[model samples]
Target chain A: MRAALYQAAGDVTVGDVPDAALAEPTDAVVRVLRSCICGSDLWSYRGVINRPAGSRLGHEFIGVVEEIGAAVTTLRAGDLVVAPFQWSDNTCPACRDGVQTRCDNGGTFGAPGTDGGQGEAVRVPQADGTLVVVPGGPDGVDEKLYPALLALSDVAGTGLHGAVLAGVAEGATVAVIGDGAVGLCAVLGARQVLGAERVVLMSRHDDRAALGRAFGATDVVAERGEAGIEAVRELTGGRGVRHVVEAVGTPEAWDMALGMARVGGTIGAVGVPHTTPQLGLFPPFRQHLTISLGVAPVRRYLPDLIDRVLAGSLDPGPVFDLELPLEQVADGYAAMSERRSIKTMLAG
Target chain B: MRAALYQAAGDVTVGDVPDAALAEPTDAVVRVLRSCICGSDLWSYRGVINRPAGSRLGHEFIGVVEEIGAAVTTLRAGDLVVAPFQWSDNTCPACRDGVQTRCDNGGTFGAPGTDGGQGEAVRVPQADGTLVVVPGGPDGVDEKLYPALLALSDVAGTGLHGAVLAGVAEGATVAVIGDGAVGLCAVLGARQVLGAERVVLMSRHDDRAALGRAFGATDVVAERGEAGIEAVRELTGGRGVRHVVEAVGTPEAWDMALGMARVGGTIGAVGVPHTTPQLGLFPPFRQHLTISLGVAPVRRYLPDLIDRVLAGSLDPGPVFDLELPLEQVADGYAAMSERRSIKTMLAG
Candidate 1:
């Protein structure tokens, strides 16, 4: 089967890889229907996050079950499904508490011996607990809904995670610190699900600014650094917002997220931080701030998001600004790495 | 009037100082009836926290209003009151939100030019906002209630703050990560107010362990560091507790607090951290933890704690194991610094 492999920094290609097969009794083989390039994927593609030679490189996919091992019960062959970024046993204590990312025996898709998402066929572990079956089998689903369904696997779920962690509620003034697809989705999550009264998105690009506004951002701050802080303060009438969603993992973004929150407020961060940052005890204490940081429990949120997408209340399809065939995966990476596309969806 | 002053790193002296008088329109002079040495106060006595020459020491007191400035409306002469560690205008936005420590124009008791709590009298700023009036004036209150009232100013309130921030709910398993007066108070707060099903206290001192049990600790973990983590895991069936109260400010205590919390659990810290602690983004993210770090907004929790105290349901008086007159305030410092007493109460 052909799959994308990270050969080295600035080099990736679609090449023949091992065929996907069930390696465990609880596993299932999935023929990938749709896959995408993530902002996080750029970390390794740009040589920021080290990747060994010929490493499989994706953790988001929606697919059809090609085959299942003896122990797989809830799913069958040819079933349409979405797999969360990480495979988790939903019955674990952590999973029961809605933190499946911390499941006792779960791990990310690209770990050694696990299947990466950006491929024609992949193996899924703990299939019954990790895969969410779409209501309509492969036959009845609309082609246009692929992007939205694929988003529930990680992107949209992550944004919703940030919103939930921040405790966003009615009558809240929220700030989203990044303008990426996840950040834009956070604006949607805040306004649509959490009932935030107002949401401000910090965006430098005109394209993303438009997307952010479309995603329900009430305002956008274009400046960065101290100027950006001042801009947010100005918008908030000298005080900062009561809730902030940090969608970018840079230290500067973390600082801005903290700066954007008012006293007794919260900042929920979902970005994969690339830098080591020191949290100042005195400043956060003085502000009475609470910081909820981590990766999204994607599996925990995927079911609800899938329902939301199928219900036609949410349309995150536009986040994929570029689309191409699976063989053009390298071009997709280049487009995203060069910031020419917000995200790229590949038809596998 | 006499006030305790930190003469140097290891020396504190009580000597004649300027008479307590109202210096602002909103100020009030308090005739301090009871003051106590705090765990935080020992930081200076042990030379851990540097003190300038003759810096007024102490920040926990209960007193009677001796005189009032022109604008002091809610309090009057002869009224008994309990002042929080920090004085704040309850009318500020931050104060209105129940975080009075962040009140605009408010500060700690021993700050330069402010009257310290360990004195015969104190000139309080924002008199109406900073002082909580004791019912029936100073006449009906018994001397036995003095130490309990003093605890409201800092220790008990701080513990309550940790519980409140952690959002402790009924049936929750809680771990209080210190054996200090504040940690003991946290155990009480978790049981009495937060409805925690089980409360664990990490204590090394036999005396404090006994006090912890008396204060409602369901279990005691005497181990520290990795062993402490293992002990807590054992108590909770290999999973950590749902909530943690961090009363120790050191990085080790903070780490333990984080380590003790289950996935999606919270750790509320009231310790004043002395060292710069680096929060690893990936670890917290993977654990799905929320860390609420800060000093307690003492004034905000005082009224409820005061009610609890007056009802005879909660007593923090045992924490003050030694009593001394105001003139021998130096002995109070010596006893606490040498670990001869858990805390010292000074009679004014």
Candidate 2:
């Protein structure tokens, strides 16, 4: 099988790898149908974060079950399914508590020995606990829905997780601090799904801002840093918003999220903190603020999000501004790394 | 009139000051019946935080309403009331949202021009909003209940706020990281008021630990730092508690609180962070944690706590291990500063 592999700084390639096969009774072989590059992948691509040479990359995918182990009960061969960024044994206390990302036996795909999602196939551990089957199998679903369904594997679910952490509710005023795919999704979820009365998207790019508006952002601010926070506060009558979705993990983005929250407000952060270290406690503490953050438990949200997508109420596929064939996975990475694409999709 | 004054570092004195009188249409004059030394008062006494020489000192008090301004309608002369550490209008958006500490027009009792709670009489601003009256008048309440009533002014309410921030709920497990008056109260509130199933108290002092046990701490770990975190983890089956109450403001205490929380847990901090600078975000972010912190909105919690106290379900008064007449206010400060007393009470 061919899979995306990290070679070194500024280098990624498609190369032949061992075929994914069921290694345990709890495992299932998935023939990936769609996969995509995540913003976090850029960390290793730019050498900002170290990755072992020749390691598999990517953690989002929608696929068909090629083979199921003897113990697999909930899924069968030929079933269409989405794999969350991380695999978890759903019976663990953490998974039962709705935080599958921290499940006792959970591990993310693309780690050293794990099968990467950006590949021809993946051997999924904890099969019954890790995969969510689509209502209709591969043949019943429209091919056009592939991008959105693949999104449920990571980005869309992550965005909704940010809104949930921020405690967005009916009539809430929210400020989304980034304009990436995840940020746009946060804006969409905070307004459309979470019922936020007002959502301000802090985006300097005209293209992303337009999409944000269509996705339910009530206002858009093109400013960054202090000016961006000021713009958000101005929109909320100088009190700032009650909920802030911090989709960018940079220190400046964290600061902006902090400054945009009113006293007694919350900041839900989802961005992987590659450059950021500490979130200064004093500022938020002084204002009685709440900060909820982490990688999204995408699996916990898959069913509902999948239903919403199939019902035609959600359309996050447009976030994938650039798509490439599996053989050109390198080009997809280059497009996202060079800022030429908001997100990249690879047809498997 | 006489009031406690901050003369300099390590110095506090009871001295003659201006008489308390109604200064605004919304103000009321309170004849203080009970006042107590708080852990926060030591910050200025030790010069950890700067305060103006000769400034009023103290923020918690229970008293009789001596006089009321023309616009004061909810309170009357001779009514018994307790004042939260900070004065708030209680009608502002922040106050309405149950975070009175951030009330738009609020100010602490010991601010330069404000009357200190450790005085014979206090000129309280925002009378209707700042004072919660005892059901019975000053004469109707027993003198034996004075200490408990005074606790409601700050310590008990602040402790409850910590549990609330940590999201203490039925059958939840909690860990309290301090054993001061506030920490002990948190133990009580988590188990008695908020219904936590089990509570672990991290305390090095035997006296405070005993009180913590009496306040419903299911277990006590006298260990500090890493050892303490280990002890807590062992008790919770290798997973830390889901809720942690950080009642001490030092960096070390904050770190311990962080270490004692399991993945997806919450840390509710009510300590005045005089020595701590920033809370490292990476650790919590990686664990998908939630941190809620600030100076507690004591006023918002006073009524319920008062009801609990009056019903004999709560008794945090024993946290005051030392008592002195108003003339010996300096002695009370020394006892608390020297660690010879858990807390001190001054009889007015």
Candidate 3:
């Protein structure tokens, strides 16, 4: 089977690799139908996160089940599904509480030693919780929306979870601090599920700026850092956003998220917070900011999002401006890395 | 009128002073019935909070409304009440949100012009929100609980709020990071309101230990730093306490609060967080902590607490082990300063 294998800088080769088998009784093998690039993928591309040679390189996908292990009872041969970025047993206390990303035995797809979802086929662990049965009973699944549904694997779920963590309540004014695909989706989430009165998107690129606005961003700020904060504050009547979704996983974004919250408001962070908060008061107590960080536990968010998309009220597909064939995987990476597209859809 | 004024280090003295008059329509002249020494009061005694010469010293008190301004409607002459350390308008959105400490207006107490509740004939501002009407119809009040009610002005409310902020669930094990009267009262709050299964009090002084146990602390850890953390983790099945009330206002106490919380638990901080949190990854991403800080908006927690006291369901007075005449406040401060008393109640 051919897969997107990380070889070197500016080097990814789509070629034959050893086919994956059900390595665990709880696993299910899926034939990849659509995969997508995520913001976190750029971490290794920029060498901020080192990738060992020949590492499997994707975590976002929607595909058809090709095989099922003995213990996998829910999913069977030729079943279509959308898999979340992280795999969980669906039985841990945290997973049961809808925070599967913090599952006691949580595991992520892609990266070294993990099966990458962006390939001819991939293996899923704990198939019951990792894969959600697609609407239309699999056969009615729309290919155009496949990129958007596959996005639920990580970016979209993370964006929506960011909204949830930020406490984006009905009529809340939300500012998403990052204009990546996830950030734009956070705007959609702030508006769609949380019923935010206003969604503000902080952006540096025109490509994301358009999608951010389309995804319910009532305001867009092109500036970064303090200027961006000021823009959000101005948009929010100088009190700052009532809720802020921190989608960018950087110190500056973290600080901006803190600044863009109203006093006593919350900053629901789903940016894969790598930087640990300090031991003392990280920000002065006045930000009255409550930061709910870590991965969004996309499994907790997938079910509701699928319902929204199937209902035809939301169209997250607007984020995928540059779709490409799975064979053109390198172009998709370069496009996202260069900010030419908010995301790229990989169709097999 | 005379008042105990904080002059300089070792310079606090009871002296004659100009009469305090109504400064605002919302203000009232309170003939203080009782006052007390607080752990925060020691900051000035230790030359920490450089208070200006002759500034009214005390912040904790229960008092009688001797004179109410025309605009003060809820409180009247002869009405006995507990004055919270901070003044809030009660009508602001922030106050309505149950965080009166961060009230849109009517801010901090005991700063320069801010009237201290400690002295005789002190001015009380924002009476509607700052004062909790003492029950018993303000007639034949239970003088025995006056000290405990006075402590509620700051200490007890602070501890309760700390526990509440730390997100202590009913029936969970609770660990308090300080052993002052506030920390002890937090044990009461946790046990009575939150139904804590275990109340662990961290105390270094024997005088505080006995009082802590009397106030429902099921266990006491005499150690202070890293070893103290180990003790708490050990007691909590090596996972850390389910909830931690940080009642000590120092970096050490703050660190202990972070160290003592289980992953995904809360740390309710009402201990005057003058410093930033520094626990890094634990606070931000890994520990999955929810940190709520601020002066306890006792106004929000008061009605229920006042009821508990009146109904004899809770006796917070056990925390005050010594009583001193107003003239001997110096000795009260000295007694607490020397660890000779758990807490000192001063008559007005």
Number of the top DockQ candidate: 2
For this target, which candidate reaches the highest lDDT against the unseen true structure?
2
For residues B1-348, write the lDDT of model 3, one tens digit per residue.
767878787666788877878888988888888888788888888887677787877777787888888898898788888888788888887788787877878665566786665577678788777788887645767788786677777777878887877777777888998887888889888888778888999998887788788778899999878899999999987878768888876788877877877766777776766545454643546666666666677878778877777777877887788887788888888888888887888886
| Regions of candidate 2 where Cα sits further than 4 Å from its true position | none
RMSD of 3: 2.4
Candidate 3 runs further than 4 Å off: A275-284, B204-207, B218-231, B234-238, B275-283
TM-score against truth, every candidate: 0.96, 0.98, 0.94
- Span of 10 residues, lowest total lDDT, candidate 1 chain A: A274-283
Q: For candidate 2, what is the lDDT?
A: 0.91
Calculate DockQ per candidate and list them: 0.68, 0.76, 0.51
Q: Tell me the tens digit of each residue's lDDT in model 2 across A1-348.
A: 999999997899999999999899999999999999999998999988899999999999999999999999999999999999999989999999889999889999999999998999999999999999998999999989999999889989999999999999999888898999999999888887889998899999998999899889999999998998888888888999999999988888988988889999999999877675576677888989999999899999999989998999988888888989888989988999998899999987
- Candidate 1's C-alpha runs over 4 A off are none
Worst 10 residues of 3 chain A by lDDT: A275-284
Candidate 3 chain B least-lDDT 10 residues? B275-284
In CAPRI terms, model 3 is classed as medium
lDDT, ranked from best to worst: 2, 1, 3
